[model samples]
Target: MTIRDFESHAPIVDEETFALITELEVRKAVRLQYFVSLLGIEADVEDGQDESEASRTRERLASAIREEIRSCDTIGLVTTEPKLYILLVNANLGNVPLIIERIAQLVSRHRRPGDGLGELTLSMGAACFPSSARDRSDLFAQVGSLITEARRDNAERHRYRLPPAES
Candidate 1:
């Protein structure tokens, strides 16, 4: 049987490179592989209130996120409304939650000494490539779904609407 089952997910991804990397499980070879991706910007915290200011804040946060992510992670900056960053993890899905927490913390650490507001918060969604989706488009959509879920979740968890979904 062919070991090329890729699932579908969202918000949107440019998974251009195609590969057939072998996947090994605890005691046997697996027929499925997964790539995890983080979608959207954390919206809970912010330093800028206006468009230009918000853009700059987002740029800084995106840059910071890039530095925090590992070298192997595929990081892509999405040019959407709120400005989103994407992290593609190829190792496995088991580490996804940890990765997300690390990202959240990284953003927190980079936040400037309360220019008035305290910590910086962002909204994010994550999806597993080849597991949540088989094609790039589907993966993007799933990530987007997560982003929607995240916005609502963040709104409730943080108290404010996280930045609007990025382009």
Candidate 2:
């Protein structure tokens, strides 16, 4: 397996490594009095699509996210599912929404015509250290809850054939 440095653009790390880095960041935040934000992003691909198409959509989404994030941020994959984690160093609660909006716009721009794919929806949840949570575990829990809520909201909009939610 290839190893990517921390500064690499959206380098995909495993769960253990991701957790370790997040814990370290939490510690640093305690000492430095800086904020750290964690975002849980999940991509929803259309059903009945082939595995290859879904994989390509995921790759494109990841690329778009990588392009929007800063060099200090980190991305990680915790499972085979389309869920991803982004560690935003020095980002505060006020900034997470802006970052998420930017990512959504970038992903929308990256979509191509005739890709044999339906709309790729992204559900994101964010928690900031020192503001939203006491530590890494709490941060993770909050992010998870937020992601779930976002997904539910998205599904509700789709069920009613309503327009997408505003950023």
Candidate 3:
């Protein structure tokens, strides 16, 4: 089957988006702000190697993220990384949580126990352009830092997903 047949959501080209962002910056389009989010799926090591499992998890997570995003928005895989980047065109910073929540719901639905998927969960961080970043490079840097912070926060809590509330 073709990619289109399997994946209905057409992801934007990361290179092309980078170029477009450069043009947008040159045009001084400060009024237009895009929400850039970096998302990660971490899995536990089942055996001595978890590379294949991690790869599958990332692909599944990317598909879910692509489906969850708006038509106007774009999702792309970061080069040489397991992370996926989503560009929410003309979206506000406040919308970040809603976006992440959507992704979390999808991830949870897709996750299954002992299917070699491991104890997987999604982690995301978003930054708005012109407000959180001045340019594409700045935006990328900030988003990456934010994801790292999110992971660190999760580590501190000693869990990837939120714990169940006590009755």
Candidate 4:
């Protein structure tokens, strides 16, 4: 998929290219010879008081994510909102954690001081074709749901944890 448009600082695939890639995935499903994993990433700024700063941080974070993806992998902003999806060709489910860790490391390593309110957390979810899903639409739906769940989990985990009081 080619990103022909820009949403803020993020590269986004046009609807036509997105559909074409979906069709290609469907066709590839017939052989079941290739392994493709769809990784969904959601990033948001914790402190949204400064809209401009938040936008810049999100852009930097997205750029970092794009840098981490392989040449064979296709990254695109599926929505104008804070979300990205990577179509990793020949990717294995077993190695997903490593990939995500790499992404997180890159994001953190490249982040400017105090970007995203000092905590630019990433929520990741992945689904493999012919394994987690049998078709393009199913793959999209499953990964979408997975990312949403992951985001919810992250939020809950960080929602109400007070630091130690001057121990």
Candidate 5:
């Protein structure tokens, strides 16, 4: 089955479509002098599950995120990787942490026992237009850097026997 076959309550767009929408939003933000936040989400399911199971986990996580975001927001799935992108129209950097926390809570609530899904981990990074970046490329680059930082932090926590921070 194609990647798009995965079930999601939220509308999931391809990378190209997402990029176009993001560009439009960025332009609007520039003209209106508002804020736009782009969030990059990466979900990791513990190994041992088959491909189908992994895809299901992703779907569930996406649905949970959808519940936390507004109707104006958008979710994009990268078919080549286990990554999801969220476009928060008019949302600024200050609003990112709260959104992330809500998403995390929703995902946790949706988790089921005996599903063999194991522990699902989400690493998120956010960037806001005009504040975190000057243009689309810079915005994406900033998000990528933040994602890398989040992954590093997760790794450090695991290595040091520290509790994982809520995303």
Candidate 6:
């Protein structure tokens, strides 16, 4: 099983969208921001207390995130220390902020448990393609770098996400 690097295997899309795709492909990569990585949190639900309750919350939020995501979104799984890797196909640096915000808000509101988790401060970061890096090595580095930048400036303008939330 040869692992394909994201830098090498870009998402195949339309021509007009090609420019946009390439731009995004090399710009947004979900990774650790500052020290807050967006990769894992399912297992960290029990930071202080409520294991069963936390588990329930995780399941609900996970469900919400998965359901809200589109079908084209690519998924990469890594069961290393207990984290899930994800890649929203055709996603880019511009839209990650919206996705992150929607997910965060949904998690916060949908997390029925409300027993522990609050505000749902999920610090996330994304790295795109060629613009962000060159090859696979450079690609990985860019992912981390972008994440760090996002973490530092954690804003609501990451770009290319869902439409404005309904009031």
Best model number under TM-score: 2
Candidate 6 local lDDT, 33-56, one digit each (tens) = 211112222234435546456545
Among all windows of 10 consecutive residues in model 5, the one with the lowest summed lDDT is 156-165
Tell me which of candidates 5 and 6 scores higher on TM-score: 5
Question: In candidate 3, which residue pairs clash?
Answer: none
- In candidate 1, what are the lDDT values of residues 89-146, reduced to their tens digit? 5543455656667766775566567554345555566554555554545555666666
- By lDDT rank, best first, the candidates go 2, 5, 4, 3, 1, 6
Superposed model 2: Cα runs more than 4 Å off: 1-8, 50-56, 80-82, 155-167
Candidate 4 segments whose C-alpha is farther than 4 A from its true place: 1-12, 49-58, 80-82, 114-118, 155-167
Clashes in model 5: which pairs? Answer: none
- Top-lDDT structure, candidate number: 2
lDDT of 4 by residue, 59-166 (tens): 556566665666556666544432567777777576677888787778656667744356667767777776667778777777766766666665442121111123
Candidate 2 per-residue lDDT, tens place, 1-167, comes to: 33344455766666778889899999999999999988887777788778777766665666567767876777876664326888999988778777877877776576688765586777777888888788999988888777677777754321111112336
Q: Candidate 5 at 112: error in angstroms?
A: 2.2
lDDT of 5 at 38: 84
Question: Against the true structure, candidate 5 has what lDDT?
Answer: 0.72
- Model 5 TM-score (2 dp): 0.81
Which portions of model 6 show Cα errors greater than 4 Å?
A: 1-61, 80-82, 114-120, 145-167
lDDT of 3 by residue, 41-68 (tens): 3333235545665666666666666777
Ordered list by TM-score, greatest first: 2, 5, 4, 3, 1, 6
Candidate 6 worst ten-residue window by lDDT = 32-41
Cα error of candidate 2 at position 25, Å: 0.7
TM-score winner between 1 and 5, please give it: 5
Worst 10 residues of 2 by lDDT: 157-166
What TM-score does prediction 4 earn? 0.73
Report backbone clashes per prediction: 27, 0, 0, 0, 0, 15
